[model samples]
Target: MPAYVGAVQVINVSSSGVFHIGDVIQIRPISNTKTFSGAGSFNTGDGLAIYNQYSATNTLDNDGIDQGINFNL
Candidate 1:
């Protein structure tokens, strides 16, 4: 695949952004952005839940729900 360009105007590019102008073979760009408001927890369990503020994981290590229940009856 290829593209033909004459004139281009780029106002701004984010920190995780890329801009290129040329005849290229392959271009692979990856950007992983995460935003945390209250908290960021992974596989958390609370017995008696209180004022709750939780966040989920963006990785592959998390269980079913980022927050869980491990009860021993």
Candidate 2:
């Protein structure tokens, strides 16, 4: 599934069963690195003066789902 830039997706682990409407699921952002550059500041030689980087790790949340997910750059 494709999640939005700032949205979150939860995946539940189970052998076999029809999940109920409110059944709790186990999931977390194994890795989230969202970056952005400011348009307000720009240098003639360098480019944007301001930059932001966001990263998510297991420590950010404790959903217990290990093993990193693959992403295509």
**Local distance difference test values of all predictions, in order:** 0.58, 0.45
Residue pairs of candidate 1 with colliding backbone atoms: none
Tell me the number of clashing residue pairs for each predicted model.
0, 0
Judged by whole-model lDDT over C-alpha atoms, candidate 1 comes out at 0.58
Q: Tell me how far the alpha carbon of residue 39 in candidate 1 is from the true structure, in angstroms, after superposition.
A: 4.5
lDDT of 1 by residue, 1-73 (tens): 5777988999998775779887776655555444544442343677744555665545544455443233312
Q: Which lDDT value does model 1 have at 45?
A: 72
TM-score, prediction 1: 0.32
Clashing pairs in 2: none
Error of 2 at 23 (Å): 45
Error of 1 at 53 (Å): 9.2
TM-score of each: 0.32, 0.16
